[model samples]
Target: MASTITTDLKNLSISEPVVIIGSGLAGLASANQLVNKYKIPIVILEKESSLGGNSIKASSGINGAHTTTQSNLNVNDTPELFFNDTTKSAKGKGVETLMDKLAKDSHLAVEWLQSEFDLKLDLLAQLGGHSVPRTHRSSGKLPPGFEIVSALSKNLKNLAESNPELVKINLDSKVTDIKVEDKKVTGVEFINTQNDKVETLNTSNVIFCSGGFGFSKEMLQEYAPDLVNLPTTNGKQTTGDGQKILSKLGADLIDMDQIQVHPTGFVDPQDPESHWKFLAAEALRGLGGILLSPSTGKRFVNELDTRDVVTEAIQIQCSKANNKALLVLGEGIYEDLKNNLDFYMFKKLIKKITLKQVVEDYKLPITSDELAEHLNQYSTAAKDTFNRPLVVKNLGDEITSETNVFIGEVTPVVHFTMGGAKINTKSQVINKDGQILAQGLYAAGEVSGGVHGANRLGGSSLLECVVFGRTAADSIANVN
Candidate 1:
């Protein structure tokens, strides 16, 4: 774990290394499986100077069904239940085969992470679009993203030292082309960002783990023009580099227009208009937070519902004084979320403010009594417009002007793209016209769609990287 790797570009030319584009969760998961199982010669090409991509920024936990964590929590869950929830949330937009596979393999994926890196995914929370408590993280101070990615990165670094000839990591390297011979992927052309040297790796297998187009204005303009004005929670490197390479080769694309606008990107008071904003994690709401409208002091939507439903409610319901929604949490929720809140507060995404500041700063046109009545009514209501649970933990409790609470301004951001190159259950890329691509090529992660339908459930993105990334590695092993 102490070793570091920066492969000399010249050495890759002689090795015929299996090229994996992008160094995020998907690439790391694939490489880990390939090296562990087959000792396959591997080269991970990352455009960024660092390893972990947007994956390290993931705040919510990963999804798993019927895992040991769920069992320990005395939560009854099964793969069938998870699949049904996913299919229902997808609303017929998800590929049935892919959704079913994701649901079935989820627990194993979580188990793999725990065993492989000695990482604990023992903490569970019920995020949006989930029927039960199944999403998992560690019981540590660091967020789940950093914990999982750093463990995988550390393992790979140490492996590069111990098995230098079997594994190589090339940073600041962007894969520009997938060279094909006889309609089979043979290698890739990439450029070193540190120096402007163009390079190529000769290999018969290539896995596209490159991320989505959430941060690409041009790609958004081309594919999702209406969403171009929204902010994003993606890294600058997620400009659909893999999509461009696959599309030109006539690979099939799925749900290109089904972009997901996450309901809660924090609006920094100091810089509210910036296109890049910190995500107010869905876990914040899962652990009992509430969303309020400025025009009215009452709850606007079921804070625990699917993200799309909540985002639409905010857009239609929040008062026009600010294009934002008010998120509030009570003492109990705070106790469960102190670690995450500390990071958000340090980033100035959430902070303590006076009750008067709700009106003066957030522009919520409500009196202290009005706010109290809203809390009281929400606490006791049997049926509401949105049908949210009446007894939310630590929220809708007694409130005075002096009561301590956590609050923030949140807005919908273009968070995830549910569309990308099409891949089957086997993780083989398919042509848009419903044909399979070359045998040696594969795709996983956000770069490959159909795992999610119209909307992606919270915590499933990381699960996807492990499930399908390893699936691709297994496919490659079988092919060779």
Candidate 2:
């Protein structure tokens, strides 16, 4: 039962549909659950002309624990272990119940995409902050985010076509306000960007998934003042619209200052000063790349350390090297990440060269002998490395004058805002006093926080979207 709402604002004001804000994975996943499981009519409002939000830019895969894919690959992991790793990564600020739910449902989240949506997530890798390889993606050139978003968007469009009355997607519409009456959400007011006209839509339920405010300079200055000038990888629409709207409705925000800085945003040689930078996926290092101080030609941090830890190391190293560091990948890593490398090389963000060439072309401070010594030490340490304490192993063949490698200049960039409106385990948006703000208003994905306390793991962002997005929809679906 899918239907489109008429363009007439008056018609939308009279119809009470389940309205979901944002077209990211969270919004789409919630809509999928509502339409497929509950036969509910939905109206999704997106600020951008295209459907996919920042979700389309996610380069790394999604995290899952003890999935059939993991079992087949002989990865020994459990929800408990995943929970522990998450808590540790969060540095004790994590909400235990929310973290528990996230870890517990991760396996089902991945399986749901594969079984229900026909998305392939058979390949797995161990990203930073993981004890084992639980992040799943397809063995293809397309990034996991693009693949999942494309699949879900196409499916939703096809369903809308078949049942036009059940699903309506209004692109270029930005929700500006959430209306409340008798302490419950009754509707939302949004602006149609195309005509700069405001309209109100009556809805029994609203799912807020508008994403984080990483790109909002004002929000950054207010909440995370220290990161005001840092580069970011988020889309322009990631201005915390959902967070702002909910805050005005008295929803409590949690950990607003907890921002994540990714260690390896590529520093384009042609535009080194650009504020928008391309993220060098953590999968590159997970597959055996190493970060080196361009000045000293030495490894300063374990390649697989958490984003914050590596970012700190890179900052310190860059501070000493004129804000420059190099990420070097051997032939094995280059081959595994050939698609990513191809894009980077095409953009001139990285270079393919022999070890001697890297030394000579970049004018590395250390001699070839010193660089070889470091490579030998890393290769020796990575042998038989599999779980826990997350060591960098399998660094490929030892570096020699003739060895080939891919190298890119990298720097830390403001990546993710780990804070947003607070939500309960049921995915209901809550107030400052630990009470649900409105019966019909819910939040999930990056728009709602507290699942990740201080720092988020590399791949958990996507998992949060799928798990809580569905939870919010299911909670609304069962609410009579």
Tens digits of per-residue lDDT for model 2 on 1-480?
A: 223242433244323468899999999899998888888788899999999898887888999999999988899999999999999999978588999999999999999999998878988878888889988888788899999899888878988788766788889998889889998877888888888888888766899999999999999999989889889898899999999899999999989999998988898989999999999999888777777788687777777878998888887876876566888887776556677889889999988887778788878898777787667665655342232232334445455777777888888888888899999998999998999999999998999989999999988988999999999989987785
TM-score of each: 0.94, 0.94
TM match of model 2 to true structure: 0.94
Candidates in order have lDDT scores of 0.85, 0.85
Give lDDT tens digits, candidate 1, residues 1-480: 122233343354334567889888999999999988777778899999899888899999899999999999899999999999998888899699999999999999999999988988988999887889898999888898888999999988998899777788999988878888887876788888777777877778889999998999998998889899989999899899899889998888888889999999999988988999899999988887888887776677888889899998999987473558888877677767888888888888887764556656765678766676567666666755667665344753566565556888899999999999999998999986777788688999999989999999999999999999999999988877
Model 1, total clashes? 2
